[model samples]
Target: MLRAELAGVFRRRRTLGLLAGLAGLPVIAGLALYFSGSSHGHGPVFLDQVTHNGVFLALVGLVVSGQLFLPLAVSVVAGDSIAGEAAVGTLRYILTRPVRRRRLLVSKLVAIVAFAVVAALVVAASGLVTGAVLFPLGRVTTLSGFTIGLPQGVARIAAAAAVVGLSMAGLAAVGLFVSTLTEAPMGAMAATAAVFIVSLVMEGIPQLSILEPYLMTTHWMAFTDLFRVPISWTGIERDLGTQAVWGLLAGLAAWARFGTSDVTS
Candidate 1:
């Protein structure tokens, strides 16, 4: 079932377009950096200059996309999972089968997560290839001014990619939850995107100090702290914890909504 769901999603033109757009972003960034003449600088060129500046910049763009576009992409898949079928009058046929609601929801969630993972890797691969082509790759310089050799730099990039991917699971769960609430695919996508945008806006308010910690957007950039010298696990741990809580809550909400949903209509 999961495989079938995945195949269906991959066959969509929207998904293919999104993949192309994501893959092109880093290449565009790389070209921009190359023409900007910002590559020349002092101190271990590989560390102080290339890796730090290039990778971090690419990451910032990737993170921004994650916060904004990625959720929409997840919603594009999840938001359409059941609601789309219902809209097309195919859901009644699906529900006529003996498949359990829980199993159906689980399969859909798995497919959504799988898509998210692939999307993330596409972003990372685009960034890495761009970084390596436009900027010299060797060692990386930490935010705290420490230098990491080439091998270590490679490892850190991999770890960073993993962290970013995990962080997005929260957004994926939110999309899944929204999916169960509506028959309109656009509504689910917009609702999920609006929530993140609102969170980001709220996170920016100076007086929202009390609300910031509760905002998922606040912790979305926690992976950036990993690049600091000595590597601050505190922020990353908190981020992961918060994400886990959100994911669980959203998953429960999705399950509850879907279980009680009337698909016979």
Candidate 2:
């Protein structure tokens, strides 16, 4: 079932388009920074230092793309998973087969996870290559008030990329649940994106600080801890825990809805 799901999801032109757009971001960012000369001490967090160490480009790309594009890309796939199939009348047929609805949802969710992993790698790989080509690669100065060697920096970049990639999976689950609520894939996409946008906005408000810790997006940037000297696991641990909670709850909701909902298509 998972194999079949992978085959169908990857075969779509939309999937290719999402990956292409993702792969292009690092090129654009890397080029602009490459020609910009000095760091000027400006731009997204950690981005200004890219000229110093190419490995930082990987971190910078994750930071830049994580803003909106990353979630938007995965949401596009997760948002479309079930609703898109139903929109075209294939969902009913699939349900009629021996494939349990829960199993189907699991397969689709797994596929989304696979896509998210690939997307993160694309950003990290492209950014690293572009940064190396355009600037020097060496030891990295980290936010944790310490310096790390080239190999260590690369390890942190890979680890950070993995965490950031998984962080978006919670949103993917949210999108999956939303997809089950409607037959319009675009609607699901918009709704899923709206949830993140709203959480981000609310996260910025001081009055809402009480609710901040519980918000699904609250700990997203905690991946930055990888650059820390002692490597504070406190926030990253909380971040991954929050994402898991969100995904599990959302997945359960999706299963409940899909299992009980009528399929009239």
Candidate 3:
């Protein structure tokens, strides 16, 4: 069942398009930066470093898409997990099989999580290739003012991608829950996207500092810590912990709702 679910998820044109679009992000960014040129201490978080070390493009692309694009993609896929099937009137038939509701939900969630990880890795891989072709490849300077060899730098980029990818699992769970609540995929997608956007906005407000720690987006940029000289895991751990808690709650809620809910199309 899990294998079939994964195959179905990846075989869709929509999934292919999403992955292609994600891959383009780093390529476009690298091309623009290569042509226009960037200086040290200029632009966004990793833009400056991208020119000096091609691998930084992986980080830059992740940062660029972290805010909105990646979330939207995750939301769309997750939102469609159940709702899209229902919208097309196949969910009811799927439920007619011997598959238990809990198992089906689990399969959908796993597929969504897989897509999320692939999405992040696509960006990183694309960035790495594009950056390597367009810029110089060499050692990477840690955010803490220390240098590391290219191999370690690449490994860190891969690690950062994994962190970013796993971070979406929590949102994937939320989106899956939302998908169960409605048959309209667009509605689920929009609501899920709004949740992330609202969390991001609220996290930015000083008055919400007390609530910030609980927000899903609070620790998104924590991947930057991976680039530090000593590689601080505090922020990354907090982010993963936050994501786990959220995913757990949402997954439970989804199981509770989906387990007993009636299927109609």
Go through the candidates in order and give the C-alpha RMSD of each one to the true structure: 3.7, 1.3, 1.1
lDDT of 1 by residue, 1-265 (tens): 7787789878889888987887776677567557765545542213224444565444644565566666667767767777777678776776677567787777877777777767767776777777766666655677788877766665676676667667766777788888788788788877877777788899889998798887777777676676778889988898788778878898899999988777754
**Residue 3 C-alpha lDDT in model 2:** 96
lDDT of 3 by residue, 101-137 (tens): 9899999988998898889999999999999999999
Question: What is the lDDT of every predicted structure here?
Answer: 0.71, 0.87, 0.91
Residues 1-265, model 2: lDDT tens digits: 8999998988989888887888788788878888886568877788878877777888888887876888899888998999999999999889888679999999999899788878888888888898898889988898966899888888888888888888887898999999999999999999999999999999999999999988989998888988889898999999889989999999999999998899876
What TM-score does structure 1 among the candidates reach? Answer: 0.86
Residue pairs in candidate 1 whose N, alpha carbon or C atoms collide under 3 angstroms: none
For TM-score, the strongest prediction is 3
Order of candidates by lDDT, top first? 3, 2, 1
Best by lDDT: 3
> For candidate 3, what is the lDDT?
0.91
